[model samples]
Target chain A: MKPMLAALVLLASLGVPLLAVAADPLASPGWPIAQNRFLTGKTYVFDDRVQVIVPRDAEDSTAVPGFVRVQGIPDVQQIMVFAELNPIPMIVQFWPHRLEPNIGFRFKVQQATPVRAAALGADGIWYIGGAWVNAAGGGCSAPSIASADADWAERLGEVHSRIWNRGDEGRRLRLTVMHPMDTGLAAGIPKFYLEELVLVDDADKHLGRVEVHASVAENPTLTFDLRTGGSVRIQGADNNGNRMLGEVE
Target chain B: MMPRLNALLGFYALLYGSFAAALDYQLQPREIAAGVYIFEGRQEHFTRHNGGNIVNTGFVITDAGVVVIDTGPSRLYGEQMRKAIATVTDQPPVQVFITHHHPDHFLGNQAFADVPICALPLTQKIIARDADALLDNMYRAAGAWMEGTEAVAPNCRAEAGKLTVGERRLSVLAVAGHSGDEASDLMVYDHRSGTLFAGDIVFHGRAATTPHANIQVWLQVLRDLERQQPQILVPGHGPTATDSRAIRETAAYLEWLDTTLREAAAAGLDMAEALELEIPERFKSLAVIDEEFERSVFHLFPAIDQEVLHGGAGNGTR
Candidate 1:
């Protein structure tokens, strides 16, 4: 009984089941862990014409491999898709259905997070693909354009978009917002953050919304595609009810 | 006890030798071109150990007064530059042009307190806000090399525009994409010598540093410089190369990086893998290729994607 008691005491000294000792691999100093935490549940099929390719180790921050395939989409046509986190959450959507079964683009991860891509097939089924990114540093918390509140306030409602013609019916549209999509990480003068909510709408239709991260670069630019010719509008508002709008043609 | 004492003395000597070696700052001033000089110094920091010597403080003796381009890394170095200039000319340096806000080029401005210093407006703002941080980094890097000195600061500022000194026409273009502040372009047209002082814009034998750099806009600025076609080019660092070939080479290097990194990014290659990929044939033999290439690639990969893929604006003017 003495020996058993002594063994128990040794175990206790070794910090077994101590509330203070938590198992957190990420908390270890200088240990390399996955920086991107993007997770995809299942490959969602939009239509028989569209094929989505998702990478296996999407958790790695430095690499994200993906492929997109769509049947009947003409080759040489522009392909547009949106990552769900865009202030519009539409990463890059473009028009004129290209026939190529594959399209690819490389993007920086603001954090270890998941990226969802939604492709609008010619048949109108939103094919969805997802990838995770492990990136270093809090990219979303990086500083953006330094402008006065009054100056940023004046350009609230103006939305602008530039549609590039890939030489034919294919069109690539790039959109930008004039609002500060404050991610609540930055300090404004008296230790306050410029937190705000922004919405992107196309022709009175709800496109998507993004929880603005402070790490986004100033004048957050979004490039996407649309099969239809219509105007897009962006609305932004801070917690204080300051609002601004912009339009793209 | 005697053996132990001998071992202890050996250890102390080893430590002292290392400390003394690091503290020694070797600065060599080479006359690369006629009436043009480059004060080449080593960056005494671990972060900048790429063997890319610090090329700060260049002097051009003009009919009016000596025109110094870039003020060395610190006040002491700046004084060294002034002394070097005095060896060649009796006239005081009337005007100083800061190529950018990098501490190695601008902190020494304090050495020329009496001389009027000029830089792009953006550079002035960056120096005003980030100079302290830059100096702290320098001090930490120099360690024993700067054992007995305080960091110096820039005194005068230059608005972005044109200024004429002697027969030279200096134009401060607001080139950005390198630092938040500092001109992307510093075009000095020396009518007498037909030379253009192309700051850090063109590196002759080494890959360019891309921290806080905008590759696309930098390429555009190079194109603009090429169009001017100055007879001689005096780079901010390294030996000057004649004609716009250096400009083309620098642009080509950037383009290769842009395309290669873009492909790697598209393929979902990790940053480390991308860096490990064999360097192109063009840049294989350049000095500091292996030492600094990785860092340049790391900074440039994301910057290029931001500008080209994301449609981010060029680095200059906000």
Candidate 2:
């Protein structure tokens, strides 16, 4: 979603129409959005250079495949994924240190939502790509069908992060976390999910920026475009203030 | 004579085509144990090509009458199974045991209309609750295969206890079938032959479906069954095993999934990332890992996420 349209969707989804108050969260937001310093006052454009690929129809609601590609850019700074229909629509803000403008990943889609991937470049301008995906819509509410084993309790919160070269100039950073990403919509299911995610270098320098929406799907997956081969680390917290950290090579 | 031969061949071809078209898949029974015959189903989900023939059925020949364990995916399958069983035994299936409430296991109940169809009380209740929807889904997935199919609830409750079938005494253990604490699965053990009819509990090479299952209890039950030393194992979807190896195999896979999901959750990866995970070398050999495992992650990740969010004491929200 472009900056204006992302804000435009906020107006449509939350029914709050305001131009002056759209700059910051405290001023006024269409909804409750996680505060971000980088997103302030940015005019986003519908750029053909950016392409967001998502199946028009989701085969599986939870782990629906998606990708973002930024053409004509050698070094892209950040990519942000958004599910316009989700209660929390900021799927993830990704920073790629190796530095390509392309990434592929998957997340949940609740109903038919405009899945938007916004690419930020060195020009400080934001380019947006989007697709309308018609999902059966249980990504958030459906029960996780992984295992019924009692031992799975001890294995929770584990992360398996990997970086596979795209064979082009960029690489794919894939990580799997054990989380339900529950939306509390299902009967008796509470809203338990990851609330924050951060990408950093060895020195803890923020590589890219990201924010996740409740529609991120359970056991969320984050994929990023890596332009260079460098050491990177990921750290995040869930709603209960539980924190996790991982590194990808 | 040549014209007559050609005419005879044409008549036979029409007969063969109609018969083959109606009974698309043969219900070939393989005797897994003494008086125990089984029909191994294909390792695939319900699709038009498969005709919903993705369930295993077993028939036990007793001195008094025959006892059938699980009807196949459709009424036609059950009819074919009955005909196949009759070829080996004179007695008809006096009683039919519905392993669980899965459409593939119980939709064939119409063919067993004459006999008492038994299921766990919870299974019957679930069947009753989701009958119309499940049937509708089956029809949508496999149109012609589900033509004669109807959702039939078990009239008799299959309680966990010892029961006599002719001269043989069978131990019917009610096992926790789903994470919901419903006896969604049943283990029928024949002490006489040491054969364990593990319905949907022990998937050897076949991938177990997790739509309505509790993996924790299932793993524990498989461990217990392994220790009991069943001579022959008859799973709901895979080839029968002579040893308790099937139990161990199924338990190991669930354990692997437990570890994978736990690690992924801890790292805060989303379901999509987890779904893209590479199957371990050991699990790569397992059938349906490609199709079944991803679906399972979608189904199982939610509950696990809730478990961790609540600090392992799950909120019982699921």
Candidate 3:
């Protein structure tokens, strides 16, 4: 008990928050718990350079668009995004090997909550960024429209993609694939969604991969910035092992 | 005693002004052309303050009877509109034409139940399927104003081409894209007055609602209407116009919305970012521009983004 009190005094002297692993910039109540669950004793700091963009008012709660840019932190090994208050809080994880650490995605928000991104740097520290996304609620529990379609099975794994020129910035790749991305919160619906999307160059060299989750909107559309241009292949599979492949220049 | 009576009169006046005036729709019809009168609602979105009277309803008094074009938003509004029309003419409403299935245009079917309430076949079907949900939304939006209002489906089909009722030579034209479906919008051109009732297809001053709009199709319909060159144009919302300015304004707003969404998509701006994009200064004068623009972005940006991503030929939205 003496040692614990001493440690608390030391933390207080250092101005470290007793609750959170690090001070949350967004002041989310669930940030401390999220840090414990995701980081789990890993060192991290709240960084403004890791920008997370979201609308102040989300009209369509089911398809709230989000973008994260981790260009401020170099040598990022992996990045994970989540909504703090969602039933299924985890959204996606990206292992951007050779691609830029910038990604855009549509996510489901059960309520107005903090949406965040944590980038794991090579130095073994997690850098976090987040923003408050206001919504009308009930997005996660509502079953996706694709789940209601009788012929959704036939349309599964279909992909549409395009690559646009960004001049000096980088090439932008936007793509959407047919999947329900069911969160399973709705009654009678089971959890099902794409688990991985692997981006490959024309030479069959792997560039990066995005691990999707049930918190993503149905028929998820994703946008990414790549350092290089040329035709690229997008190969993906759902949790049930259904696979799809598409190409874009 | 005289002072007390005056005080009592003042108290009653204040009470009437506060409660009764607020509750009443107080519809007044303005004669835009010979035999054609239009009740222009306030250019505002539905609110408890305004009820759902943000739409224009008109009637043409002819030798046979009155031809009512598009009933107002709710049953109360419909009842009030009928009373207002009676002040000008003793003839009852013989035929009711619903321009489309939008709640503000057709939800007043109860007032005109005795008459043949007509709409496009598709419009009638859509109203049958969606009116209840639309009415529920109105209740949520306008609160007590929508009390006791029930959605009544159109009982008669309004066909395109010449429609003669009494002495009024009406050309019923079928249009679409405003309601976001094929052959859903119906426009009436009165040959006698040269007045055109352009339903929700045209809006003056107020920003257009695009929940079910196809921008390209809407533009084409507008162009066709411009060619008609009616003497007076009564839009579904805002003031009645003598020229084609309403038609042009609606076209311009739709075009700007279309272009803005397309460019934002091509630029890789997400929907959230697109919502933050600035509205042009010229369109700033339009009523509810900011809210309507936000709604339009939410309703449309996904398809436009998909289109840009697919290089224009992809099937947009399931």
Candidate 4:
């Protein structure tokens, strides 16, 4: 071996510290770094039970539908979604307080990348699942249709939400809010997006909470499965401190 | 010395051959009227084979100079279009009127830099703001054909009134809705030849792209154009026609698209489900209809869904 290689091998034998190599299931260059950042100092396993469902190809990079459903896990507390190669890699972090471990939302994909979902179970284990999404890219930086309108600010924080009862499949609530969700990557646009959103039952009990990022699409849509059919209120605040409030029956 | 001369000749031949093969649009201008000629483009989408030349471009030779309408998709196309105009008429081009701010229609503005390139005031603004992104899209779709191509903003504004270019009295109309909210589609009517250049407002056989379209308003604009009733019509795409068939065809397709999207939204179909919906048999003959339909769905669905599902109130004000 070369002298440099011999020296490195000798250092390794002497227990020199080096970055641990991670075996990423999707074989993405961004996965190791993203994993380290999002799940810092936390151990994770590639679990098939932690399901991440997304289209094989994003027909529209600006709003690609994605869902995460955790099965075979009895006690799931937290869930996080990541698009490993997006400029903003962490798409969302959810806390299912009284709701099921299922979420459906649309997010931007800057390029073809690995989309991952990690469910933190009551056992303190991070179970991860992921899929590859092919894309034409530029989702994060493209100016949204809302940004072009002169009066988009007048209608800002407008929320439209609906509930559907699927009986055996459980209840679903879909909420859409009007916001630019700008990543600020485009020229002459500032970063603005919903920072946190919480769903509350009629009794003011927290059903679920989601921390959103700019990686979400403009006019973000968040769908969730409810444990029971009842009226709920959504309260949110954007990075610019704009209040997004709505109620759905 | 003889050997060196032969090598030099070989080098020139190779250079000529490569240039000929790579950037040749093979533009053929067909005269539709007296002093009015059109270089009809192919019906295919932007590809390396077609070099983004999928839109019709034409010119009118007036007593004083040549008035060009709509440059093609790339810098090479614009350069070649200038050369082709030279072959047809000796008059230097005095003015260039861009039909709309779409990349295919105005990426060639660089070729007419010396001429006063004109467009609607709004079209100029939209082009200036969105030109970079649109040009980037052209590069992605057309590849190497866009080499050295840059988005050149229109230099002058074509106001909504009669313009006397040389001896030709042309009526310039500023219309909207065919292109999106921020665009103003420009149509020019030649009083002498009785020919109306209906920009993207009229697509003959090809499907209309709706990345920036408001269909209801677009239909109303079509009705306004039909009332003018020019003897000859030069559509933005497809063959030049002497009748109003192009206008009717464009309106019919847009009407169908509008109804389809509304019904799909009313039925609460998701974007993916709407994309999978079938197209009628009549529209199957239109070139690139499927791709355009999907693109329209992507552009129009989310807004339509909100309108149809929740009575058009985008939530509530803060």
Candidate closest to the true structure, highest DockQ: 3
Best by TM-score: 3
Q: What docking tier does model 2 reach?
A: incorrect
Residue A146 deviation, candidate 3, in Å?
3.6
Q: Candidate 3: which pairs clash?
A: none
lDDT, candidate 2, residue A210? 54
Q: Sort all candidates by lDDT, best to worst.
A: 3, 4, 2, 1
Better of 3 and 4 by lDDT: 3
lDDT of each: 0.53, 0.72, 0.86, 0.85
lDDT of 4: 0.85
Candidate 3 ranges with C-alpha deviation above 4 Å? A1-61, A70-80, A95-97, A109-143, A201-206, A229-231, B1-21, B266-273, B276-278, B310-318
Model 2, B58-168: lDDT tens per residue?
888899899889987777777877888888889878888888888888888898899999988888898999998778768877777777688889999888999999988
Which window of 10 residues has the lowest lDDT sum in candidate 3 chain B? B309-318
Q: At residue B146, what lDDT does model 3 achieve? A: 76
Q: What TM-score should be assigned to candidate 3?
A: 0.82
lDDT tens per residue, model 4, B1-318: 999999999999997788567778988888999999899999988887789999999999998999999998999999999999899899999999998989999999899999999999888998999988889889988887899999999999898899888889998888887786534899989999999998899998999888778787888888877787789999898888788788888899999988888786565444555666789998999988987887787677777767754666563110
What tens-digit string does per-residue lDDT give for candidate 2 at A1-249?
599777777776775434324342112232223223334567555566777766555657776767677788656777887776665567767665554565555677667677777787788767666767766566666655433345655756777576655465455566657676666766676777776667676776766645555566566666666544677787878887778887877
Q: List, for all models, the DockQ compared with the true complex.
A: 0.04, 0.07, 0.41, 0.14
Per-candidate TM equals: 0.54, 0.63, 0.82, 0.73
Structural similarity of chain A in candidate 1, as TM-score: 0.42
Question: iRMS for all predictions?
Answer: 8.8, 7.4, 1.9, 3.7
Angstrom error of the Cα, residue A100, model 3: value is 3.1
Highest lDDT among the candidates is held by which one? 3
